[model samples]
Target: MFCQLNKTKKRWRSMFTVVLTCPKEQEKCKLPPEVCWHIGASISNGSWLSQFLSVFLTDLKIDQIVTFLPLPPRALPLQELVDELYNFRDCYFETHGVEEAGRKQSDVAKEIEKTLKKLEEKEDHFKHKAEFLLQKGRCLNVAPDFSAVAEECLSRAVKLEPGLVDGWNTLGEQYWKKGDLIGAKNCFTGALQQSKNKVSLRNLSMVLRQLPAADSAAHAKQVMESVDMARQAVQLDVTDGTSWYILGNANVSLFFSCGQNPQLSQQALSAYAQSEKVDRAASCYPELHFNRSTLFQYEEMFSSALGGYSRAAELDPGWEEPLEREKQLLEYLRKVTELLQNKGKVKARRLRTMLSNLSTSALGPCSSPEFRSPTGRVGSLEPRTLSSLTQGHNAGVAALGKVVFSLASEGRMAFTFGMVDSEETCIVVMVYNTADSWGVLIGDSVVIPEPQVKRNSITHKDESFDFRSIRVDSPLLLIVNGKKQNVQSQLAASVSYKPLSE
Candidate 1:
């Protein structure tokens, strides 16, 4: 004798809403079986929500609503559901709002503050003391007083417990804050030796990131070993916050060394996300935001990149990288908009006016450095004249369908792929190895990425052309070992080119 379907129906009676099925709204519904019908809507991704609802609804005093159901539904008498729901709701709201606000930059300072308070509260606990000290030292630029206190605390902890792995890590962090790279590196090494903790491994990797090129090979070796050790740490404790942070950072370094593989960038993002979740209050938010910004930039989501960098800047205002990136994003966005505008388009016209104002604002007052001409001579060249000419040239290039692609083939540093066009000849400049390595590759038969996007014409305001150019698109592939030390060897591969029909 199987239980009847009526039991399942009764179980759902109180849980479901029947707004239209109520007696007051009966005339609005013409369908059969209307008495029990419900405009049943529960939240999507119902796995977490169902359990949450199960708990929350138990405490809800909808007695009349519950009375509509039969006795089989009486299994809703669990107290655990109520407690879990309260906690889950609190956490869900906080995290969701934080993510939606995209205010992850302030997370570092906030977390550091919380950690400091916790450390002070548990001053006698050696592990907590060391962690607090280390985190405080890392965040010293914001509050230098914390750094002094952190160092003193770690020094005392080390004296009390010579083999404490975290004490050594805290010591390393203090050295790092003071710009003593070598000392920091040695301290991290000592910490790693004392303890095989993921946090220590990550600290070691961070110290290695500061090493010079001559020392980078050794750093890379250590990083790989640390990664292997971190993998084990992750396996041992999946919820370890420090382990995931280390893994994310390790992958970032690997990507920077191996060249810009989007997949690797994404992997790094996922690891960072996991780390952020393992401990929402971790002090690595700035790094996470910066890395994620770089990923957005790679994906050509310039607006998102700008937002991420802006957040990173908020987290660590003195960090120049994100600031520079934010400036670049604004400039690129403006340039892209101008190149795409059609004549008499109201929005485009508005954007142009906005961009004009931005350019003017960027120049600032005459005495300010932002406005001061790069050229020292006052009468020799009008700065705005030069700027206007450069802007015009760039705008023309963009309008002519040339997309600037930042390329990073494996084992290669990032480089600009653009064309050098003068009156007589046009040549592709494969600036290999470094930013200044501009090798003129004279060619018309170059293999451009397929199915190029059409761009507007520079001559006629309303006219657009279906054409391909090098200055407008992002890179496509991540070919390993594509980085050659010298471009001279590939000189024979280029052929001379004449300007195409406009």
Candidate 2:
């Protein structure tokens, strides 16, 4: 005989109810009231169920019956479930390169939710619930549209386990993402109180740079401290590219705030170079490229600047700052090139008069008779034309020119102007750390001593410009209209804040 079974176990007392009629009495007969059988089991020849049914059927002198049903799922061990969840989380964190990590974060989040739910039901007995909570918080921290919940979870985790360093760091990062700098700073500080990890140190360094200070001195101190913290983090792990990148940023901050020192710029560049060498994955970071580009742009290394900006833009398409900077730089170059190209047509007569009127006697202390040329000639200390300036620093030489066009200041830290010598050779002059009130007009004479020349040939997108430029790190080195300039004031450093990642 064949029979069907009901799938619902809770609603039905037995697998199924069967009714049969006796052959002689013509009356209905019922089988056993209770029959227990698991789903997904087949009754076949030689099977246990088949054997049991065969014996029972033989007692009643009945034929054989066969059936198949679904099986119930077995309960998974709690430890095994936690282990699986941790493995998945580890895979997500260890996967380098966001693009290649094809795992869906939403699915991971769902799994985390499921585990959390299980842990919560056994909260009174679970010993490692706080750790899993931290994992869930971290997973939510990176997942999209989960910041609020991530913060809540992270807060709960830290509350449950005050000594959890990772929880504090992650909570700090969450606050950073929300633009709560003070909260972020506090969380990082809390993490440091528990441990001296590089992540917290580097993150604290970044946050310190953005924090406001009481005065210029305090600001300078804060920036220096930030640099020091970053250095410490780098020392902790020399191979950490993220730490190196933060060090570079801190140095850049020092460069701008502490008088636009070229040495500081060089230090920042060195840090960036070290970062790239030790960590190839650093190339995947957009902010590193962008900040490096900023330094290059400041130094008038146009080609390298353009390349960095381009790479940064490619790395993060959602970020518009790189694109804007690239456009502004190209436009600036185009304008500068046009101005230089038209110098002859627009101010030829005035430029000639100014050049003729230029005198070495007006250079005062700058016009030294003991000054020796690059060739070590004593008598050749006289002013040379812009065309005579070779690539790199023209040591022991002075150049006199008439300013023909003044480009607008960039970041209010550098003053750029175009100038032409007696030979009508035009070049760009960039003076750093100059006050906003200081102005170099169109017809003023500019005398530069030991001018540092940089040749730039940049071709970016649909724009191209070629020019030679001079970088003057200090205004005290410049003589305008035969009078030596003094450093009365300097533009304050303009620091930028952005979300950073490791």
Candidate 3:
């Protein structure tokens, strides 16, 4: 116990006692790392004892890492160690090139045979055996895994070197791809326990996301927890694009499970866009676009969804998910177009953005130049809002009140809510006419780049939390306040949209 007994200070209200263990009888209660290092090196006592010394020093170094302690001499740097591990993983992955599942099963088998034969000539090394199994597992003709053999080899490799972080992570992934969620979960947990790292944490969070849910609410809770882990991983290492993608994926899951949370949906979309910006593989990443496209499809943004799905299909022709979604969305697109073309019953349909001075629809006071209109932010629906969405305006209004992104309940439209401080790091959804980035999408479609709403030449009022909505009905005439500007999205006969006005 550490005490201030000799001091004139008050009797110790609290004391912290630290105890450390030693392998052998030590005369001193505490030993410096240098002394430990020298003693360890001397006792191991052979030219080949460098290995044991390295092991000891490495453990000591790792233990001190969170404390931000400097490394003792003759110990490996953590980053250098991580680099070496990654180099080994990359070398193995690159050596085989991309494995084509159905076509190259025999070739992969042959490659395994060659590797096994070469290994027979040497003293069977753990890394060599592990590498053989890794190649075999990765090359297996089944989807994304080698079945039992790959798992067996990978499991053995980690057994051979329990400290090998990469092997544990890879094995965990293999298990996950094979649908052994519990097995995958355990492996990732083991990896994190052994080595707390961004890759392992990110993987663990994804595995958590995939775990089977007991019920709807249970799944939502799980997704929220998983999202927290994913966000933590991203914060730990922003450079890792995979972490960002995982974060987006978790948010998307939460968006669905938690009664279709619009805020979560927005987070999912933003995270995805950020992932695309940073991830080089996004160009040909089928899963990335497919997931993103799926979001668009749910939003009834058909044109955007179609583009995403098409690009995903082009990237991986074998993937079925994109093809299926594309087919469904195409039908939706046709229906939307036909509905727009034959709208005899409806009064009118358009995203009615009326200025105060407009004759037909005047949302704000013409006298006051400081009022900003409420803007709609798009959100994807799962089972909710789609029925009314597919139907016409009244159905839309009825469904709009129940929409996942419905700001009407909050007394305004979507995109109307933002931080009071505009410059702060926060979500911003502005008017289509004034926002630099905005687009229009009919049901299940966004036509390439929707025509830009001509920028408002007038300045806007200062931001406020005070929100109010007014009822205005007008045919979109593209004329306001005796001035005209070009709007990219037009109200044609076929376009399907209900004005967000009561």
| TM per candidate | 0.46, 0.71, 0.47
- What is the lDDT for 273 in model 3? 78
Ordered list by lDDT, greatest first: 2, 3, 1
Please write out the lDDT profile of model 2 over residues 30-148, one tens digit for every residue. 34312222322324224554554445456666553433222244334455566667556544434534553334455567777887677566546654567767766765554433388
Kindly report which residue pairs in candidate 2 clash with one another: 39-70, 39-71, 40-69, 40-70, 40-71
**Greater-lDDT candidate between 1 and 3:** 3
Top-TM-score candidate index: 2
Q: Model 1: per-residue lDDT, tens digit, 1-502?
A: 0111111344354443332234554455444432332112222224443454455455553334421111121111112322333233223334544443333334434644654554445446534454444433333323322266667766766766678776687677677777776877787778767866765666665655555555545756755664565566577678866677667766665655554455766777788789778876443355566666665555444456667777766655556777776766555444334332331122434434433332222211322333212223222111222112231123211111121222333322224333211111121222222434332221211222111222322211233222222221222211112221233222111111111100
lDDT pick, better of 2 and 3: 2
Q: Kindly list the per-residue Cα lDDT of model 3 for residues 1-502, writing each as its tens digit.
A: 1111122227524432222334332443354645445544443445433453345446555353211112344433223433433343323323333343223335444554544444343325433565544444433322344367667767777877787677777787777767787887788788888977877777777777667789756866777888988898899888767778878877776765554556877898888777767755443456667777666645535466777877766655566666776666554333323332333112223212111112212111211234222233232211122122222222102111100111111111112211101111111112211222322212111010011111111111221121111111111211222222245422211101011000
Relative to the true structure, how large is the alpha-carbon lDDT of every model? 0.44, 0.73, 0.45
Over 4 Å off in model 1, which ranges? Answer: 1-146, 215-223, 229-233, 261-263, 276-284, 314-323, 336-435, 439-502
Question: In model 2, which runs have C-alpha deviations exceeding 4 angstroms?
Answer: 1-128, 143-146, 260-263, 368-381, 409-413, 461-463, 492-494, 499-502
lDDT of 2 at 290: 92
